[model samples]
Target: MMRRLSGLLLSLCLFPVPAFAQSKPCTVSDHPEYTNKIKEFTTESFFSTELVDHLPLSSCVPPPDAFLHHIIGAPDTLDYTKDINAYFRLLASKSPRVKVWSIGTSEEGREMLVAAVSDEANFAKLDRYKEITARLADPRGLSEAEAQKLIAEGKPMYWADGSIHSPETGAPEMLMELAYRLAVEDTPFIQKIRNDSIILITPIVEVDGHDRMVDIYLQHKKHPDKPPYPLIWWGHYVSHDNNRDNLGVTLALSRNMLKTYLEFHPTVMHDLHESVPYLYIMTGTGPYNAWLDPIVISEWQEMAYHEIEEMTKRGVIGVWTHGFYDGWAPNYLLSIANNHNSIGRFYETFGNGGADTRVRTLRPSETSREWYRPNPPLPKVKWSARDNINMQQSAILFGMNNVASNGQKFLSNFYLKSKRAVAKARTEGPVAWVFPADDSRPAEQASLLNLFVLQGVEVHRTERELRLRATESGRDPDAHKEKSAEMSAEKSAGKSPDDAKSKEEKKPAETVIRAGSYVVRMDQPYSRMADMVLDKQYYNVSDPRPYDDTGWTLGALRNVKRRAHAQSRQNRCSRRHRRPGQNLPHPAQYRQHARDFAFPPRFRSHGSRGRFLRSRRPEI
Candidate 1:
């Protein structure tokens, strides 16, 4: 019995969560008729009492085993975690084409999983790929094609999940309704979706934190709830609240899981979280605000918010995003995190920014102002300006110009250029990719270039003073001394080589944090490199945007100047190393001296902030 018990534990741990494990059986009718069906179950109707009495409440227990998502006990918040997982399980059960995997451990060590829904049988038949696709769009409408064409063409098949923050529970709960529609085999809607697009889901983006909330609710009010369950799970890890960002302890876990997710290069990324009340009365997080993508902003607004607003017209609370509380999770994330949380994060895949809303969820007069809701005009303005600000940020996750391309094209470009430049100086080469946008880019700006040096790159940094720089070889001082000497002389010489030594060499150099190999170099004049503060957004969920240590809010840009002396003094968030063109005389201080900076050419204010400030409030 002991051996068998241990074996069972091992099996559960190692075994991939089977598709059916995400949900249980459920009866779903056409949701388009949702209004009529719900009307029959309203509290005001004569038979409302009978209908209410029959409603399921099994989740209120020690928590329903994989099936019944939740059962309200008194009156609080809904069980978002249970509902989301259970609903996903149902999706797995009815759909033969889907597969799911729990990718990482959460803050509470819960299994964070994802579902890949595609036609496996069709995909298996390699020879039929083209034929199958052609048939889906057959002019005669009689070709026996499944949804292969839609799959190939990459039409928008929405993939959204929620609650990176546990208490912002509505999104995961709402996902249940979406899951029920897609999972059942017999439903016309389910069939149509499967025949049209392959869907992927990571239902509980923050499973560990979410479960902590769910467990507390289950322990208290649930067994002992009503139509609504508030103050959910008063116990549990309160510190874990709003932990959508990577905690210092969980760095490895976040890195690995995110890397795996990147393999799929998803077209859309929905980072769900709850919204605060009081500050935002009208609506909550939502689809494309004008701040992120202007061209398709209106389209997304129509497709998502229109449907969401209609849901609001009914009894459904907290459905859409607008002026009252248009606090958008995706918008904030994409702005600073560099589009990984925004709509056009498509190089990662387009149409990605996925977020949630707390619009009508709160009582009309009540206030849950924990969320950062800008005033009416500000949020709307931010929504509109987001596209431009976010486009500026996109350069970091990928590059500038909203152009997305993958594959190695420029790794050797810097190395080759540096090698030639060093050969001409006949000095050991200091190779680096440069950028016009990175914070450190300013140091490398307009100057006598310093050698990046031969020290190991420190990928991690705890403070602004201590940064990482690229190192070509192991820790051997003599070898570095030789290289540093030549490199130092190259900089000490007042004049840059008049020869147009390949702009790759002549253009300023930079050092990159996170990933990407091109356009990086040593600080403008010193061997010291700039460090990217990668976890800015993770540390503060108040603004769930993506960014590295080097990142700053454009809100911060107003005080900044292109020159080193001016920037460190002007920008509060910024740290200074030295004036641009200040070369490091010593090799040992390179790591400690390197600092991340930002002074994009765009930063050169076109005239002044009087107009710019009002024009670019949001990060679209």
Candidate 2:
């Protein structure tokens, strides 16, 4: 059935078909002046006439109108997920600049697709670019000169996704247009973006929610007088909480995104959202996560401010930054990129659930001018799906242009950040973290270690018991004990206690790690991410309230015993005998081990029911 439908869709794309009838198809004649105003504003302000005039629209490739039967963002209109996928397929089928593939399936079993739009030359050498980014992501063996050579040869990869929340209808619609522009338009601006960077577009992140929301939206439109139908949940399991699964990566969508990040190593990852006054590019209100490199924070501002400045210059109002969210939490979906030494930012545009034009009145707080928001939105104004689409599409174009123009700088910065991470392990402390295997909870321990491996953090297993002296002053318990004894003797001999205690405090301690432990050395490129996950988070009390959970210490949550050792001396027992996956016993093995343990007679299970059916009588 799907194949038949796909064939029919291809036929429609290959040969123009008559417009499909609808209960109410939005047309230019309905509001010709408003339509033309938006069209002119987007073209002249976003892509100047010089660039637009140079764009070569191809007859072989179908525009969004060919599939939707009306201009994109048309009022009172929505496209099905299947139709959107069909259009993307057609684009890839017709254009050398576009390549589409399924990343994975959604919770509801709908295919989630990602399109890579770049120069035809780039598509031919895509594997080479992937290898370049991977090498840069981990700059262990490369010298400064070699790193610079790779930087010059490599192109920056940019990732942009839309419709994560589903109700933010504008982003998904705008992405289709953006994809078409990137694939078909051959202007200098577009060509430069294609030549300099690989653009990745995931039109809809939450596939299930997109289709469900569209259904509810159409129902609401059909009965204007009745109370709107409620969508109990957006995703099958959660609503807005879908974005909160990055660290856990329990959801299919989060896993798929993380896989892509690890595979591509994109320099910048942008997620499109809606709900702010006009458009809010994320620079993030602090206190920022201490684990993040200083460079990552600065890069966030660099991208955000560039978008704000360009949009403001284009006469777009209400584009602002730095007040909505805090950067302390690393649980967001895009936070995956941020933690991995890549820039991850997002946009929040104003949206009305559907394509209909509606009047909205902003509160005084939202309208007042501020340092961040130079030209605030009006107190009352007419807004529509089309307006939302225009703002988001323009901001995205500006962001793409920024990265393309400064590809070398972005790539160089990525290499530098990764190199610094490795250098930190040598200069700073906490040389390695040890997760000791526990007999009682082997499964839990393995699960925690697996999480780290999944995040691309290197892990190794201890073949034997490891003992090393703690070199840091405060870390040595044995040295402290010896110092205490010496200090007591000195005090008894009439010496000052303070002087003796001071001398003892400078001594180093000793630590012993058991056999079968998992060691995660901090010398790797993603050491910061490993530290962020395992170490305790301390949120400042004086700072503003956090946007989400204040802390996410994985070890405590998983009930695993993990130790961060600052010892500088190398130990033979910490050798890596086998891969982490092979060393860690499977969950079933743990269960079998539990079953093999002999229980006390009174507590033993005697039958298939597996209960302590009989117990010895207590002796009086």
Candidate 3:
């Protein structure tokens, strides 16, 4: 018997169990410890008897022989795509709460997936819920009754994206486990979460980079002189700077991900990332932009504080909020959420690990106080992929849980916040920036219009001439003012200035804005984004500093004319009102005007009668 036992032990040791071993359904027995924890979590009085009775007895715990179990034993820095694929497949096959949709393909032709997870009721009416969120984000046509009804039944939509930057390896891997637990776990706490929230997760934003990084890491694993870190590029062409493409959407990955974001119009959005080695004592820490839409900012801070409290309650270690990442910078994808009146935040988890090795030992230092304040006493900091994953997982879960718990308030806030943005635009002049559709540089103006469309700014083509005071049209009023004085002097002398005007006139001419202008209205939900991109913004003019890109007015740089409606216009003839035979300037006269100024003389010449109307918004 001893000889037989020895032989069996040797055989078992030599051949370990496969990652996906048994075909049995996963249950609480696989992870009994979590079941006990769940019980402790739900013991609160708020978790009523009815709720407990409805909870599933068997938690959807992966079997001890499953892929998740195997990964726990291995290092956290392996190629997680295979694990993600396996896990998602399992969820799709068995979990009724989870539904995965392919949003679009990446630049390198990798499939991009967005998983929509909620309770069965919410999942069934997902389209209806999406429409509700959309209307909340843009309440232009929503009736008061419909809006209130939708708010009453609304659940906060939490959107989380993992690993847009390839170096931030923890998020993509951690999200897989997070998705699995949230889908399969049948505890009361989890049930409340699923029922009260709609969770949208994009596992890997930069799919091509993720695959390439994994392949590179595997190839370099056995090399003797292998680098300490993986030689991975996050973006296809732009690499690390790919995150800066939100406003322009220059990359395919950004474009597709943004399209998904616009489609869902989530209540809260979190973009996960990994920080540099040993900078702070926290697992995750970043500050929010101070210059976001004020109403939206208030709502975001409320959610953020709630998240911090939730993290503390959930026993997450070393978390901080509000000071580092500002929402004013429109370049990042998270800023899309900010611009659209959603509570958006960026989470940076500490990361410094190799495919198989833990890198450096990070401890609390004076420098740590500069970036993040520890919660009471700081926790021990040991650098490892496991630690990175835990922190990111904590941030994602607690953040979403806070929003889910207060879904009704969040839903109302979304609509009200947009209304506040519109009100703010009205209070702060100008009411609109009008750019003539017909300009000497029609192609250049057209290019700028396309950029505006990409950035989600609402553009309207004027039907008729919008008559505003020339002094308030954002042009140099001094020039027009001087011309007015000259006209007065000419009138006082009783001379007809029109006939006696010098050939080389130094005086500015009085100008009237024509029809066919593209109006960027300030009283819109996305007014902040519109203003930031189109208006002339000063850099570091005050004590409080801007996070990034202090001075950026793409419209101004492109020499596009912007007629500012500083004061409300008296006449609102926006459509075709010009008489056919009116004294419109000749096409040659427009060409001469274009040449006189340094404007691009690219306007199409119609005829000698100047049927072609070239217009541009004057520079501020």
Candidate 4:
């Protein structure tokens, strides 16, 4: 089945099939005599009852002092940090299947935790599994034989993180319950998941915001007349947009999450949230984002649709596809994972009020005739805490089942897609992108290099200055488009194509690659992702709109001299330079160095000179 799917995808990529007309299949009749007349039809045709019967059955056991129980009986929402930590800690302390680690500290002095839940045996050797996944992802340091060995040993790791946004309340609670079920339930399906895969669950990504939200909700209940202010920032530095820091990775939370993401190299990852729910999954409200590789999107859709089908068969209501959310923004953590050749899914459940209080909100089916009501006018429906919890639980269950059932295929797809990326870079693209290290702006150069390192892009430094083939004008697609537009307008106004641009402007320039210049080459395993981040990506925003910016060139942003290099006749590899910060001086350090040496260049600040002069030392 996996081979068939892989072949189909490869064929589609190599030779796309055009639209073909098809005739409708014979239909089954509801009439009793018609059931017998249609041999292919039966009562269980739409959904196989036999498959559901064969599913691993289990009993749900509520913990004696479950936090959900306490929350239900309590008058107001409670601080999740205290209760959540206590619950997970207790579970880990008691169950061999569960292990908890504090991944990092949040902005407001709270611990961010990730719980690893697997079978007891897998939990014992979890580090081995993590290492295998990491090696498989990069493969630079591994021999072909060694890579094959690791691939055989590797188990798919599925990551799901919650509550990155404060108001998206369902995920944290659902994760707690899911953790309990995975740890306690001895069902064959749960056991298979534990045995075949490792589940990484970060119950709350934004610890500070969660506590703040709880406070706001508890306070709001006390004064019903006062308006509720449930929304709070995930980061102290950048408000609700902290989740959009995958590219920059400046915030501590994003840094921590990236560390785990790269470490485990999860085959599938989920960033859980509550939006204008109407039940939507990650690949979004429209066609899958154009930037994503088609093969991966095909695999992801297969996995998601299967789960949705199962959910529907079991009578889970309002599970929708294609309504909201576009997957264009790569800065989103989920899309970041997708760029890394993993199946990254976004789970958006309908959100109620902060404390799971019943609130008047619009259901998808509801409509209104009021003058103020717009198209698809949603009428009010009361949503409760219980419904939110159940929906979230359903999402986790479907996701886990998907991974458990398709673990090997997921692993194969990840490896194959990466291989395709490497192939594309080697056979198709320009040699590499060279960011010439700016000696004058050492700090900014160092910052940019560090960003590349954070993004897991392999980097090389030149041993000596060398002239390489380089583009002159623009670094982004839009810039190139603008340049072409200007030339086109000139040509349209009766100017010859050659006369439209001067000979000097038409020719490519040779850029001198400095000794410390960073080289991100094609042919590396993560070349596609590196290209996406560093190169100019074109988007058809006029048609199906992108969620965010189409082109994001980190090289262009830092004011570094960027050059598109063709394959060098001479070998480009040189001695590896890993330490970016040590090689370059920071801007402040540059000023301090300038002051001590009494340099001719003017510094950014004058007040610093007095203090620097008092503590003058020999500049490096």
Candidate 5:
């Protein structure tokens, strides 16, 4: 009997039952209508609740369903933003691994919150990790050994925000469930992510809009026959146009998000949106933004392809990329990360705003299989909010798993990209961009400078006047020709070439940059952002058509007088003289300047307490 038992044990060890097989089946479905609709798209294993609840969980922390009183993605049910915030606070209070804090208040007075999920040990060293990322983000004085040491001790912070558009109601719901899984699940996958990376989630980006959307959705559910009531405005002053305010930083939501980004320096920023086939991870088609680091462009594909591969491996279909959107624009909501040397990506899922199941018939073009989209969506599939939630959650999990497993790679690349940005300023031209203090439009100039400061760009005011030679300054085109003509005339007059050269050296084109000018040097880590915003952008005309605006030259748009100072060979001004002057005034000082400007009637009515300049808000 002992020998037989030993043999059976050995056989069991060789081929153990799967985790799901050993756990109890998920028999509870709060909304079978929504749950049943996705059955044709994927199996139970794809649903996040099914997979997460099967794992060992902390009894102290209740799952989202227990707290929300219904499973997320249930039909005709939408939790208000207040309830969501309350649930996040509850998670933070219950779990040592989770912490929630308000970033700022929305325009409509709703609190915008962010939740940080990680292992308890990581939480203990949270400040240390934050410092490490900050150093890596601007590696100027950092040494090779120091960087390697920090990389060994650092954890990549992955940021995922949802529902910026508000009408795409599935993201915030899915995010709430995602936070619960990360906080409570004790499975290997969850533990690995908790141990290796810090997950930061903003459940609802547009808080006011989320509640409005929920109200509209519920009202529409009441009268199925009547056409849905139109939400004339999603934000206080804008609708879907809120996503276009990243570069402009006009909206309160944009400023709050930028503040969070500057503080955390996350390695990845993932924004979730809805309205696509089944799912589309963003690897924008062509005519990519010229100002973004090449590595960032590659990183987009790296993350997108990794998500596609992982999802495909799990038997999920319609996980595609490299279509629909072009990456030529830098004013997108996610462009903040892309400009700051971080991987910024987004997801577009399929949902009809509510939990009701709807059958979607695909055209032949969408149904046909392609290289980017291996297994196309079915010709007709019963889609619901639950289906949207499952696919989004699964894709997000795979993405987090990738980042967690390759934490070192992500950290190292982040450091490398910042290092490259600093080096480019030295080797390449355009050492700095100078925004003059004597511009006719002082308000606009100050507002533009304030925008850079808000975006975390290093801004300094010159203490004294600067006399710089226009060696490579693109201004004064006739100056160079006139000098050449003078030299030619001297040579024609039988003067030696050396004499002409000496005469030319004495009278080179000189440009004076007055005192109090704002200087944005390219030697810093976020110099790419400064360059992209201040420098001209020439989109490649030969590439595919752009999906959005081709140019967002802030200086040109704002009518701010700026000059690019190239590295000069003959300028007498020492490096110390050309160095950045005193740091620009505090953000509040700029806000004071912003208030004095004359804004449009619509924006002026919103009052002076807006984030930045109310009058000069970009219309884009």
Candidate 6:
């Protein structure tokens, strides 16, 4: 019957049949009563369900002036170039509730706005941070404005950033819409959140990347140097994948902005991104563990975790954590540096394994399938303007107003536990786990000590096959020295395999190279994800991951990127240097570390906390 049905379809395609009456056909309907009915029937067809998804993909188009309009009490648009001019214009106007500033600029020369949304009282106080205006003068660079503004006037602040991933289309629109609703509407809704809080919003962090998208639409041209990462399609892609360089070596945009942001010590922050193939909208596609300490978790739970829990209970969204690499740090949690209590979460408009049945249903529905789902720390509330106020209230300043200085003490305890565990693993774990062991002394083991500290396992070494192992103690205490064959033969025969411990299962006594890549691997793991909140620093890099690139070394696996970049520069120099037999100086001068790139002396004022890091080495 199946074969006959297929054959009939084939026959219809092969032989052109008459649409009307099928002339002389005593067969069309095969029933005397149905012959007339068959003639009256009309044929209409659409793509099959399976074929429908396969059709070209479609994206949601957000309204124009998305970012500028988000600042409530007023809605405005300013060209990326004329942002400062427009900002001052607002400052000069009656929009007492909101003020805008060009807080950071991207690698592409586009300006990112920092909206200071507050009530009249807060706005008057925000004016104290005028150093932001100094940066606009073009000497310090605009990125420094936010910090300089706060520092110069010594103003306390809270910040929210979005669109570090240009493709994380959700946040730009979400945040922009938020800014708009806040600006355009006047109600108890926006007032509650803005009363005590002054929002320092960086709507677009990666302007260089965002411009790539804008370029494709307007100029019909693609930049020669686009960072490589997953795109709309899993198969076709082109990028150096640079934005992940949160450290900022080759790209100065995020790197510089991060430095300035840290100075302000914001209390609230959230970064956004679209999920890649096999990745979660919440996190990467590796493991679902988070680098958070119990204290960090506790803090978030106190403020934001409850909200997420409520949302999950209500089934407004699916559980945030899933997939192998799903567990990782949310960029916004960096608020701790400035004593800010922040929760970073992701939104998934689309699922990882491609669109499922719901996606199909939503294809014709509204575009609010996924938003920020706060699981444990955030209080469950409907996604609305009032919730934004509630979110701001959860900041360190506000949280402190409620918890007092104990908030810091509580957060400190949580971080210490997580940090101690890691420090111990780095100190006592077996040689494999010690990693590029400390090179303080001239011993082989000491030389093996690594200077560069890697995050959770990542592909670093270009060569090596490795695996993971655990033990009751970090030093592999379970390991026993081997006895002579004659001494062990008799006892070995009677011993059960289960009674004997194997290398792999012993509670991770030490971490070892398990697979591809070299020494570069993540020191953090899902098991210790709860530990990330203990310390945000990488032991080596002053900046955070994915944003600061200066911390990476020039040897080992990192050598590949450094070398490739140098080679490119060398070619450019060689071309400009040689003039047909003109000898370009014999010896080229190599600059020292700090001189290579005019990095200001990276220093910190001495304080009691400095005592702990004084030894620098982990006292595990």
What is each predicted model's overall lDDT from 0 to 1? 0.31, 0.75, 0.60, 0.61, 0.75, 0.31
- Considering summed lDDT, which 10 consecutive residues are worst modelled in model 5? 611-620
Ranking by lDDT: 5, 2, 4, 3, 6, 1
Candidate 5, lDDT over the whole model? 0.75
| Superior candidate under TM-score, 1 versus 4 | 4
For candidate 1, what is the TM-score?
Answer: 0.43
Worst 10 residues of 2 by lDDT: 611-620
- Please, what's the RMSD in Å of model 2? 11.0
Instruction: Point out where model 4 deviates above 4 Å.
Output: 1-76, 141-149, 229-234, 285-291, 359-380, 438-440, 469-511, 579-620
Model 6 lDDT, full chain set: 0.31
Q: Which ten residues in a row have the lowest lDDT in candidate 3?
A: 605-614
RMSD in order of candidates:
17.9, 11.0, 11.3, 15.8, 12.0, 22.6
Distance from true location, Cα of 282 in model 4, Å: 1.8
Off by over 4 Å in 2: 1-56, 470-509, 573-583, 587-589, 593-620
By lDDT, who's the top model here? 5
Model 2: per-residue Cα lDDT over 207-291, one tens digit each: 8999999998898889889998887789776889889888887777887787778778899999999897789989889999988
The numbered model that scores best in TM-score is: 2
Candidate 2 global CA lDDT score:
0.75
Relative to the true structure, candidate 4 has a C-alpha RMSD (angstroms) of: 15.8
Write model 1 residue lDDT over 1-620, tens digit each, in one string: 99999556544533335443325543333332333433432222321111122222221111122344232211244454444554455445445555555565654455556665545453344224323222221212222242333343332223444555555444454344334333343434335554444445666665655666565555555455544354443213433333323221123234333433233333334444433321111223332232222323442343344333332333332222343323233322212212221132211101111111111333433322222221111111111111211211111111110111211111122122222322221132232222223334333332211211111111111122211332321122123445568556766875365432443365333222322111222212111212111111223445434222323222123321121110001111112221212232322222354453332121111111011011111100
lDDT of 6 at 392: 25
The clash count of every prediction, one per candidate, is 70, 1, 16, 0, 1, 80
What TM-score does model 4 achieve against the real structure? 0.76
Clashes of 4: 0
lDDT of 6 by residue, 1-620 (tens): 99999556434432222232323422211122222221222111110011111111111111222224322111111123233223322322323445665554554466666666556676666534333322221111223344333333333344555445554433443344344333333445345455634556565666555545433422322333664333452101213343344322234444444444434434334444444211122333322222343344444435443433433444333233322122232322232221212233333323211111111222211222334423222222112211222122222222322222233333233234423333433543221222222221212211111111111111122233333333321321112323345337646688655544452365445344322222221122211321222222243333223322222232221211111100000000111211111211211221123244332222222121111111111111
TM-score preference between candidates 2 and 4, better one: 2
C-alpha lDDT of candidate 3 relative to the true structure: 0.60
